[model samples]
Target: MLSKRQSKYFKSLQLKKYRQTEGKFLVEGAKGVEEVLQSDFEVEALIGTSAYLSSLAENLKSKAKETIEAKETDLLQVGTFKSNNTGIAVVKIPGQDRNVVEEKGLILALDAVNDPGNLGTIIRIADWYGIKTLVCSMDTADVYNPKVINSTMGSFTRVNVMYADLKDYLSKSDKKVYGALLEGESIYKTDLTDGIVLMGSESHGISEELRPFVTDPVKIPGRGGAESLNVAVATAVVLDNFFRG
Candidate 1:
């Protein structure tokens, strides 16, 4: 059973301000809770049904500072998910001091991708392509957003997402900046290489400020009449081309 204070605390994490204040975020649903438990991320607390708690290994159960047993209905009230019968974990947000750009591998970067779902899908896409790091503009959606975390389907555990000034980050790096633009060279023909693949918002595409830094502007050829691709799909398409070679 959850105390009123405890329930309130967990509920507060659903908002970004509260999450930042607490240095913690909620990982809802059974799969997300399971993945966070397995990762190196620190688990502050675990809330689940008695059966769900019992299903966890002793070592996994011990990872949390505290554990609370609750009914499925109780779990539903504490998280953003529409359904959560299994469990939810209060996880400490890891420090974001690591380098986003690597010396030898391709890095995924985002510019003003404010949609949580799009950001989350892109994180999964980055994980799929084995791209370890993702740099995002400060305006990008928070990676710790519950919707984003839920959308990753556990890929959030594997991908390193850091936010910074997109323009500045690109300017400091010597690697080629491949901007996904509609009028640019078709991604199918461009010579892909290791560098930053900068994707912009669905509505705005790449911002004008960041375009000057793009050493290579590439695009996906569209035979149909679609004006633009969803940022997440475009990212997967671009990454597929990069890793195809």
Candidate 2:
């Protein structure tokens, strides 16, 4: 069982302020905790119910510094999840290499994407499309946000995300820059692959600063009545076309 002091520590990590101050965050639910454990990340504690602890694989338990048994109510009280179905993991934030991604293969970039759910789904989509490197603008959603982590459903372990000045990165890259816009060339006709694909935010599209760097403004032709496709949905569509073309 987690003590009062420990519970307080876990609960404190729910907010971004504390997460940044302490360089730690929470990964809740069985699948999320399992994925973190499977990765190289260090787990400080694994708090779960009796059934959950018993059901965990031996290798999974070995990854954590300590395994703690707690009641469902206690976990729910401390975690973001309304119901603590399985467990919550206290993980130390892994150090990242902040150097600009070298233009080698297809690198995915996000420009001012503030939605956590969209960010998470985009991470999953990047993983599915075999995109190892992801760059986000400074204003993009926090990758460590609890909602984003939960939405990734474990794909967070596979994709590498970095936040930087989008214009600086785009200005220096020699590779082709493709930005998704409403008034751009058809993605169907464009032979797009092996370069940086910049996906903008839903409401604002690409920022003006980043706009000057886009060498090729690409668009997915939609014959329907929808205003615009969601960022993740558009990313998937673009990647699908890239794969086929």
RMSD of each: 1.1, 1.4
Model 1: lowest-lDDT 10 consecutive positions: 95-104
Could you tell me every candidate's TM-score relative to the true structure? 0.97, 0.96
Candidate 1, residues 1-245: lDDT per residue as tens digits? 88878888899999999999999998988888989899989999999999999999999889899999998888888998787778999999987554445656999989999999999999999989998999999999999999999999999999888888888888889999999998899999999988889999999999999999999999999999988899999999999998774
Local accuracy by lDDT, each model: 0.90, 0.89
> For residues 9-49, what per-residue lDDT tens digits would candidate 2 score against the true structure?
89999889999999998999999999999998889899999
Candidate 1 segments exceeding 4 Å error: 98-101
Where does model 2 exceed 4 Å of error?
98-102
Instruction: Tally clashes: model 1.
Output: 0
